[model samples]
Target chain A: MIELSDVHKSFGSKDVLRGVNLTLPKGESMVIIGGSGTGKSVLLKCVLGLIQPDTGSIAVDGQDVTRLRQGSSERDAFLARFGMLFQGGALFDSLPVWQNVAFRLLRGSLKRPKSEAREVAIEKLRRVGLTPDVADLFPAELSGGMQKRVGLARAIAAEPEIIFFDEPTTGLDPIMSGVINELIREIVVEMGATAMTITHDMSSVRAIADDVAMLHGGVIQWSGPVKDMDASGDPYVTQFISGSADGPIETVR
Target chain B: MSFLATIGRTVLGFLAAIGSVTLFAMETVSHLFRPPYYPREFGHALLQIGYFSLPVVGLTTIFTGGALALQIYAGGARFSAEAVVPQIVAIGMVRELGPVLVGLMIAARVTSSIAAEIATMKVTEQIDALTTLSTNPMKYLTLPRVLAATLVMPVLVGVGDVIGIMGGYLVGVERLGFNASTYLRNTVDFLEFLDIVTSLAKGAVFGFLAALMGCYFGMRSGRGAQGVGRATKGAVVAASVLILAANFILTELFFAA
Candidate 1:
């Protein structure tokens, strides 16, 4: 289980995340949706311990991750169980596809022998719908969809207990996004990983998430099962679901 | 007022970056002496930061040496002492220009490259990916570069010192009227081991400063191409200023007597 209690974050004086409280039951996929700058990404980052919250307790599997600073042995142990997919796919340009996929398996304290790691990398790449030949190529050589797949492969390579995805479908075509959403759903079920994904893509939410949370005004405005999202009476939810400009959520400019 | 604010902000940012680098560097240096060091990464960093820096450092120093020869020749003729070419060239290049010129050259080459590359990685989220893989980016990326720059700079300075001397000798023998043996003798007689040591120390400090600026700005970049551009620009400016500042202090310490 993962939980955020009364989270608050500020940059300079502007609040990005304000008193955010949420929870996810074990092995559930929760997709957080909001317009740009509504703090969807900030919420994900807070959970991942990438950006520390000013006042919050982010607990993962009963561990207070937000307070655990990096470089501590305890923090290292804490980090051992989490996987994350960044918005841009974040594959190391310098490393080949296989190396990027199996990065966690091959580097630092988790490092295995080179040959074994290579085999594992290739296997993970295959699992991501990539060919064995593609494993030798660098990320710059791959298409955007391929890169996302590689990122997904890397996230699940270690069989992490939890996974976080940030705007996973932001750049892909709707078809490719659907394909990735299906893959994510399958992987979550197969790995039995508790997953939290932040995205504005309604199609992605419809395909992958078990629960949908709407972030607005720096807090979760509404949350429930995917079936409840369209029927939700909240104006914000209606406007967002219909993708209309004339509702509670309006364009900033 | 805006211009002053710009200067103040730049100074503050530079200081903050230096402080952060110092703290991280302390942790990295501690790791350096501890067990479980990454020998392979260290070797690669040495090649990248030091060995690769030579061409730029060498070319910069030699040309500066040649230019110094000409300038000193012109100035000394004011005193009818144009014969001081050998001594002045050796002294200027070795004592001041050699390390400073190399430092500035590296600030232009290595700092910008490191900043732009790392900043791009950061904006692309690759650094975050490194963390998810249980690899500390600081340990893997910044530490090796810092260690390599610190270790290999003395070697670079030694080579630069020799090349710079040769530059002066070539100019003196070919362009000026000085005999080869006299110029060589003056160069040898005028230079002390302290001068060489000072230059080497400057080299290490400047090299560390340059790489430190690079890594610091890169890690701190905001996002996107604009962020990376700012970081690159900041790194070069910071590296150049720090190099000059460190050179002055080291000069005072070495030759204050």
Candidate 2:
């Protein structure tokens, strides 16, 4: 389980996160939806300890994350249980696809023998619908959708207990987006991992989210079960859901 | 008052840059003794910064040495002191041209490449991905390149010094009507043990600065293609300037007495 209390962050004078508070239970998929530049990514990075908050606390599995020092063994252990899929595929351009998937297994605490790691990578690739023939190919050789699949394979290869997806379907076609959303939903359910996703795509929100939280003005404006999202009654939620330019939420920056 | 304020801001900015680079170098050195070392990455960096750099280093030093020979011979002829060509070339190449030229060449070639590659990775979020996979970017990316350059630079300098002197030897005997044995004898006899040592030591310092600037700028790069371009440019410029500055300092330390 993850809990954030009054989390506040700012970049210079621009307040990105202003007293955000939320809870994500174990084995549940929660998708945070907000407009561009709304600090959705910042909020996710804060939880991952990639960005330090100015105030408040973020607890993952009942342990305070903000206090974890970088390069500490405790920090490594904390990160070992989590996986992240970036907006871009973010695959290592220099390494082959299989090596990328098996990256976690090839080193660090979760290391395995080379042959075993390669086999696991191939299996994960298969799980993500990539063939074994694609294993030796570099990420630059893959198309956008294929790269996303490769990224997904890498994310799940370690079978992390928690997974975060950042704008997973941002650049894919509608069909590919649907396929990826389906894959994410299935993977989260199959692993029973606590999943936190940030995206503005309504289709993706509906497809992947078990619970939907609307982030506006750096706070969770409204949050409820996925079924309640359509009828949440909050103006910001309604405006965002309907993709309206006119609403309580300002369109212009 | 406004002009003074602008000057003040510029001075502060320059100081801040120095402070940042100093901290970065210290952090890299700290990580050197830490566990979870990446030997494979180190090997790859060695091959990239050392082996792949040979052709360019060789070509640059050889031409400079040849040019230095011609110029020295021309100038000495005016003084009726043409016998000094071989000795002057030996001292010039060994003490200054070899290390300085090799350092600048590395700044142009290796520093620019490292900066561009790492900056692109930053823009694309590969560095963040490495962090997610429990790999420290400093350990995986910066340490290897910096360490390899620091160690291999002396070797490159040594090679450049020999090739450069050979360039002078060829010019002296084949073009300047000097006997081959006499030119070789004059070149070898003029060079001292301390000259060779200081030259290699200068090479080590230049190499460290060049790779350090590359990793420093690359890691701090801003967003997109413009960011990568700016980082690469900054890296080469900073590395070249630092190499020149360091060369002067090392020379003073070695020969100021």
Candidate 3:
């Protein structure tokens, strides 16, 4: 289980996350939805310890994550349990696709033989609908959708216990977005991994989430199952899901 | 009062920048001695920062050597001391021009490349991805380049010294009407061990500063294309100025007596 309690983060004087509290039970799929610049990404990064919170506690399996010393064996072991797909794919431009996918298996404490690592990478690529030929190409050579698939392939390559997807279908076409959403749903269910995805795409939320959390004003305005989201009477959630411009939640802000 | 306030802010910003750079340098050094070293990354950096830089470093030093020979010959002629060309060129190339020119060339070439590459990675979130994959960015990205540049610079300086002296020797023998054998002999006999040692030492220091500046600016770069551009420009400028400043201080330390 992952728990965030009263998480508050600010950059300069601009507070991005204010007293955010949420929880994801083990092996559950929780999707966080919010408008742009509403600190959805910041909230995710805080849980990953990529951004330190001003005054909050983030506990993964009851252990405080922020206290883990960087570069220590404990920290490495902790990080090894996570798989993250960044918004832009974030593939290593200098390396070929297979190497990028097999990066975790190829180095550090999880070192594997080169041949074995390559085989595993190819298998993971196949799982994400990429061919073996695509393995030799660099990230720059791939299209945006192909790069997203590659990023997904890398995320699952390590078979991590937890997966975080940040705006996974942001730049893809509707068809491709559906394909990726289906892939994510299938993979998460098959792997039984704890998943936290942040996206404003309602299609993605319906396809991939077991529970939906609406983040507004740096806090969870509403939290419930996907079925309950439609009938929930909260004005903010209603306005956001309907994509209404004028409501109690001001879009101008 | 407003002008004084602006001046004070500028001074404080400059000092803060220095402090940040110093801390970054110390962090890089600490990571150097830690385990989980990436030999493959280090080898690639060696090729990128050292071997690939030969043409620029060679070209800069050779032309400067030829120019130094011509100027020394013309200046010596005014005193009827034209025969001093070979010794002066050799000393100048071995002691000063060779290291400084090679250092600046590296600052222009390697430092800018490192900064741009790293800044792009940062912008793309590859550095953060590395963290998620259980890797430390400083260990995986910064240490290898810093170590490779520091180890390979002395060799580059030594090669630059030889090429520069050869340029001077060619100019002396062909353009200045000196006997080839006599020019070579004078050039070889005039250079001392301390000159070569100082040159290599300067090369090492310059290489460290250059790579350090690149990593520092790249890591601290802000978001977007403008940030990457600023980081690249800042890295080259800082590395070049620091190399020149370090050269003067080292010269005083080595030869003040």
Residue-level lDDT of model 3, residues B4-88, one tens digit each, is 9999999999999899899999999999788889999999999999999999888988888888999999999899999998899
Q: What residue pairs are clashing in model 2?
A: none
In model 1, chain B matches the true chain B with a TM-score of 0.91
Local distance difference test scores for all models: 0.85, 0.94, 0.93
Ranking by DockQ: 3, 2, 1
Under CAPRI classification, how is model 1 graded?
Answer: medium
Better of 1 and 3 by DockQ: 3
Docking class of 2: high
| Winning model by DockQ | 3
The pairs that clash in candidate 3 are none
Give every prediction's interface RMSD: 1.4, 0.6, 0.6
Alpha-carbon TM-score of each model against the true structure: 0.94, 0.99, 0.99
> What TM-score would candidate 3 get against the native?
0.99
Report, to 2 decimal places, the DockQ of model 1.
Answer: 0.69
Q: Which wins on TM-score, candidate 1 or candidate 2? A: 2
